[model samples]
Target: MSSGIMKRRPLKAADDKVHDFLTTGIGRVKALIRGSVKGFAKEHRPRSKNGRTAKAIFAEAQSPTDEDGNEIMIQVKKLSKIYGRRPEEALALLREGKDKGEVQSMTSNNVGLYDVSFDIRKGEMFVLMGLSGSGKSTLERCMNRLIEPTSGQVFIDGLDFTSLNDEDLRIARREKMSMVFQNFGLLPHRNVKDNVAYGLEIQGIPESERLERAVASIELVGLAGYGDRMPSDLSGGMKQRVGLARALATDPDILFMDEAFSALDPLIRGDMQDELIRIQSELGKTVIFVTHDLDEALKLGDRIALMKDGRIVQIGTAEEILQNPADEYVDRFVKEVDRSKILTANLFMRKPKNILYETQGPRTALRMMDNCDRDDMLVIDGEKRLIGMARSDGILRAMNAGDRDISGIVSDVPSVRPDTPMSEVVQIMVTTDFPIPVADDDGILLGMISPSAAAETLRNGGGE
Candidate 1:
């Protein structure tokens, strides 16, 4: 009884901590409701049933087009999958305007996925997210034909995937794509090195080359010294590392991860998520990750596809989803996500109205500021490089002292890259003046972000 009580006490204390944390977070979110609600009310526009799909809405803004060499890695057109009855019969019932449950009841066919279509570009971290039984897993399986799609076309690099024969499909899976599961899927009989090498062995790679690749993959997943470790000797996180190492050993262009970090304890899961992000940054491999955790989706996904009842309800970048939810369902789903972490400067920056060139005089700087109804102006060089800032009083003082150029009065200003998250930007805003310069890597001024704008974005969720 004492032992049981000890365990229960710790668990109970942990639960209390979590409850307190959530309560504080909720309070902060509620405090922003007045501003966010007003912003949402102003920006919100109702959509028709035939509105453009998520891909179309975010195409030019979020995902790059073909002109940028972002070729479609995975394309699904009118894809549908059914279980129980023949596909044709199931498809017939679907076309007759019958719903999934209705078709299942009438024809004894379960509609796993229905009319799903999207194109994943190369080098993108595309996430499929939904609650359980929402067809998120089924859609992922159909992508690689692990579960053969009943109908509709799937194209990889413009090659039709659904039309491939068994042997061709096998080869494609071996060379083009690799899958990681929630379960570690390691072989108990094989050591870590041998398990990772399993894929290369199946491809008939020579022993010397396979071992070399296996060791490289093992190191890639941060398990370099554990090559000889048995699966039974490893923790849940370590076993998953072995699984990831195996997937990487194949050196496939695409990775399909089905709830890959879902099984770990929270701390371990966070570590793995960071590891995957670092790996993705270094390798830039196309990845399709499936998760029911919205926070994970927001953190890892370049673009997210939210599924409901086998239909894709919406698709967008994290900011897009938070700012413009497709419906009440999506709005509720994003309510708890910490917006400060996900919203970045790229989405919230405003155009700078008052700017002075290096060659311009202090009088010119003061004139520009006045015309824009401001006290200060950002100054840039002839090459469009951001130098600093010049306030009206500083410029006038310099002018009175016989200074000809605005450079004489320019003061160092706080600046942020276009990709800086609002979490950092918030701190900078409090210390700096309004309209912090948003510059590029080369120090070129692109735009500015004001305190009100930043607060509005946080309060309103995300917007202009």
Candidate 2:
């Protein structure tokens, strides 16, 4: 027989037998798998080649530096999910250069995702965004295996998530990641504290410890005293906070939020979005958020992947997508975005014409400020971290006061990071007389956003 005929004949012959077995004996197979997992666990838990447990591997991956110098926390390679009995045939059609619609038309398989590939870096808020049926939610579910993909691989912390068995996958889900859904999945019977502690309870954590963590998480979500109340007693926004608290209580390495704020009122939705941003900034957790709202995606995503027809149409920062869209569709998608809200301070900030060191004397500081034709100068310390701002009047006074250095006269100035949106930058600019210093997280001076620069950028509708 020919090779293709030989393969097809056996598959056809076994199809009936396999169907009969599945119809009657699938429960036994599940039991056997569970028993095997238990026996294996009793013998020895699975470990990586480096001898680290799953928890250890995921924990170490949270560090900024990786041993192999790879900073990616999650890598999805050519992931596709098809819904149909003949998914294999559909996949073959897909690989043969058929689009999702064409493949569905040919094989009657709905393509949920198509050759989707992306990487999420550690401590980054990565958003998958598109309209309904664009495969954004399907992609998120595939990453976590809530909806198993028809083909391709997902790697979390260098471990192949798709290849993991049931026991290992359960452990990874409990220890490495958590998800928040659109519907607040809080148990109506359970009080707020118990709802938040549900995951830890599943892990068989001691009650006291889990409750303590739950309480802390409640406080983190700003629902401090509501832990004793039932979910039904809270408002829509408060209930969502409980859901967020439940996910955060586990302190998972990755947080997957699928339309997390979509169910709330518009005002509450905005508030929740802000809360998420504040929490993400404080925790620095890797977040994979899914949303259909462009404004929410732009506000929350450090980088966004825009999907269309089961494939990603573009991947970039909000400013990048707005300024340089990949195709006509992407351009049309972002054509109506408010540029001021999307543009960041770094886009328009200029290098400081004159900077003063803390060790510099008043006379030297004043001279530099005069030469630059400026009334203020940013002062930095020995390590080039921002100290404060020194005004020309302060320097002049310091000169007469016989001060040794300009450090004593330096006054605290409001500062912002380069990634701060220009809308916020303009707000800060109006409140302060001096230009706002743009500093990095380490407080190192990067540049300055002057009033004129901010106004000009805003006037030109977010400059090039």
Q: Quick one: best lDDT, which candidate?
A: 2
Give each model a TM-score. 0.59, 0.61
lDDT of 2 by residue, 1-464 (tens): 69999899889889988998897698688868977875655333233334434575455444333456748889899999999999999988888899988987898899999898988888889999988999999999999999999999998877788998876677788878999999988899999999999988866666667889999999999999998899999999999999999999989989999999999999999999999999999998999999988889899999999999899999999989888999987877776455544778898788876899999999888888878898988899999899998888889899999999998998998899888878788888888888899999999998998888988877977443
Best by TM-score: 2
Question: Where in model 2 is the C-alpha error above 4 Å?
Answer: 1-53, 56-70, 336-464
Instruction: Tally clashes: model 1.
Output: 1
The clash numbers for all candidates, in the given order, read: 1, 0
Displacement of residue 141 (Cα, Å) in model 1 is: 0.8
| lDDT of predicted model 1 | 0.84
Q: Each candidate: what lDDT?
A: 0.84, 0.87
RMSD (Å) of each candidate, 1 decimal? 21.9, 23.6
